[model samples]
Target: MILELVRFLVFIFFVITSFMIILLVLFQDEQGDGIGGVFGGGSSSIFGARSSSVAIKITAFFITLFLFL
Candidate 1:
């Protein structure tokens, strides 16, 4: 039925989105440094160390949505 097809598509979309979000979240570096100071955290980061909180939040949201799907 149309409802079943819609449900299936929604499930697939959620699964794919969750996987992408997870990959991105994991790919982000947690260390407080850019490409240069990776080995040397002792040096102050020129751009400053940004927090991964946003990525974590997004990943969490995707996970919750995936579970609902």
Candidate 2:
């Protein structure tokens, strides 16, 4: 039963992460800056720059984990 619950949670996590990654990738420009410069162009840096750093890493880690799973 515990293993089954773990499997279910992992499945949900994987699906959610995949959806978010797809959304992020789809919304990004070919240059790979992501939907940043579209409207926040005036800023010296891109949107979600600093905070996105960690978020991106975490997303990447999850993606890798999902792939391995």
Candidate 3:
């Protein structure tokens, strides 16, 4: 019973993390006219210069969590 509960929780966590990663990737700016274009321009990053790095780290973390789960 506990094992099934754990499995269900893990599945939910994975789906939530997957969605978050997708949204995070979509929010990041590329060269030009990317997701940022939807809001405005890429003249400045909302998270500053290290935004891409931060996003990459977060994505990696989500992937790692899936592997462990």
Top candidate, metric lDDT:
3
Each candidate structure's TM-score, on Cα atoms with residue i matched to residue i, is: 0.49, 0.49, 0.55
Per-residue C-alpha lDDT of model 1 across residues 1-69, encoded as one tens digit per residue: 999999999988987987877796677656655545423353533233643345544655676677777
- What lDDT does the true structure give each of the candidates? 0.62, 0.59, 0.64
Model 3 lDDT per residue over 1-69, tens place: 999999998899989988887887787546554657333355334345534356655755666676776
Q: Clashing residue pairs, candidate 1?
A: none
lDDT tens digits, residue span 1-69, model 2: 999999999899878878877876555435444546434542323334543344444556656776886
Among the numbered candidates, top TM-score falls to: 3
After best superposition, candidate 2 residue 12: deviation in angstroms? 0.5
| Pairs that collide, model 3 | none
